[model samples]
Target: MSATRVLTLNVWGRGSAWRRRLPLIRDGLVRIAPDLVGLQEVWRKRSGCQAERIADGLGYHVTYGAASSRRGCATQGNALLTREPVARYDVLPLPVPDGVEPRSVLRAEVGATTVLVTHLTWEWEHASVRHQQVRFLADLTHLAERRGGRDVVLLADLNAAPDTDEIRWLTGRMADAWVSAGSGPGHTYTPANGFARKAREPARRIDFVLSAGPRAVHAELAFTTPVRARRRTAWPSDHFGVVCDLTSDPGAP
Candidate 1:
């Protein structure tokens, strides 16, 4: 492939009318047709994993990392979906503060490409924790690239804005897709979405696609529109998804 399309989204776990939201997510994925997908806040149980369900019949292989459990049944975590069969996969537990929700990064190799998916600590006061997590991710990405002999694509709902120290540190080593190619503000978490209003977070771009080698050719926010239902408005997730196209030829543009 001359270019790879990568997408990242925080699926909001099993929260906020999950049953109704699943189809919307599946439909969005179909429309986007990304080669690689990174998802956070994915909930899974014996019935079936959320990522698997969404990827069903889509010809994508899924790898999930369980960060923590929800209630007594479902496991919550991050996931990576690839168009190619996975060559190898691993999960890294991120550093978390006491009494806080657990977080993890999932890595998968497809042919010569490596993809890493993660969800960082979300609280506004948890920047220090996110910093620790980013340091770990940075090192992991470097190691992966060295071993793979190719660029690594990182997808995440980082829960931190672009200017935050955690993101700044990562961007120093990688390229931010939105900054390179997105046309607008690219706010993934905003009160503009009725579902996101419950989070009380200021409008900001927290989702991302970063690459170690490829240059971003195009990018935009997705899953921002709501679907009309008889009883209520349905959105794909609490956060908007991000889609970016990347190319290895730096001189193409």
Candidate 2:
């Protein structure tokens, strides 16, 4: 029973509101005590690092990639935190349509498993960008095979739902972790304002945990933490965190 608990969270960038949510995020991480943590929309200061802060607080090593860069300043794209030593790290930039924000995939090797984290574009009108992103992810399965990696898990805010074409494309080659574990239609993103009276209605299942070469033994929508919308605060991000428990190969260490 070689298995590890993994948690994915999209911490919207550093700003006034996001700063205030740090305690809530830290508390959530403390509660889960996951073996690995995948974070999206993280930012590193010109003189400091955001992932390092989280790693220090949680007692884990961190690896990340940049999605936006200007001169020497870079905005962190996706990050992976692991209790196990990181064997290697790489970043793959995904195609973004014009007028759309940048996106990238961050990959790290933990023990015998390789984890990839990403933040996909949110533009509904840019079908080409979605197509390219899905294609790139599907290609990762092949990449893993060539590298002799037996398992790959991708966690991210895809900005598309289960029924969407992009998701179908990606799932054609990889297993959806939630579906594999029998977690029913978990909604990751909730309206930032009041759930009902909010001007914008939540319509999509943007966040996900997709796995290959292994089965998800347990999965659930992470709503137990105070980060989940309370009466006082809407939420840390417009998206909710997703937790997946993966059962690795019995032979894997």
Candidate 3:
């Protein structure tokens, strides 16, 4: 079979900065022409929906899950876009600490592979939450196996660096795409907040694309100028996009 190109990005919110970054987002998508695209922190306000807009504009099918509880009528969460029709989709609620905001995993089936889109919490003190997230992903893998799925690709802004235990836990059963391809550590989270800018450190390699099966190949980061511009826009989010290519083996299970 042919290889599948996938792109995963975190579009902070539909803020003014996001508008500025949209052109770069559009251009990158046009250039890569990925088969699937996973998005985090997607906003769907009553007046407008960024996920739907992107899907419609790009001519891809879209599926999304709300991370937060319906407080009257606000919805925000993760989204998955695919050139192929989605066979099925669901949302997996994740553990969140008392003071932390809600988060969730959005799963969708594109052909034989299952793609999971997620955005981890920023509460560093709550290590337990991260552990729970890892367990949740493991459970999802098992669920896919039971459904006769051959592969699982998890992509997201994990909010944790590669050296952290949280990342290790999530990647325990999966191979990191970039690492497998021998690519250099591509830092994603740029300096956005005052503290981050003041430090003036290089970006952190927190965003990731991981695969549970061996079919993943040629996985690498997709850095764009829009991502840099968004980082400098004084926004709360400061993450770059991750892109990878997966080729299914003829004998894949």
Candidate 2 per-residue lDDT over residues 160-182, each given as its tens digit: 88888888888888888788774
Please, what are the lDDT tens digits per residue for candidate 3 over residues 65-119? 8898455677889998888789998898888767788899998887778888998
Q: How many backbone clashes does candidate 3 have?
A: 0
> Which regions of candidate 1 are displaced past 4 Å?
none
* Position 233, candidate 3: lDDT: 41
Better of 1 and 3 by TM-score: 1
lDDT of all predictions: 0.89, 0.76, 0.75
Cα lDDT over the full model 3? 0.75
In lDDT terms, how accurate is model 1?
0.89
Candidate 2: residue 217 Cα off by (Å): 0.8
Q: Of 1 and 3, which scores higher on lDDT?
A: 1
Worst 10 residues of 3 by lDDT: 228-237
How many clashes in each candidate?
Answer: 0, 0, 0
RMSD to the true structure for each prediction, in A, is 1.3, 3.2, 3.7
> What's the C-alpha lDDT at position 125 in model 1?
93
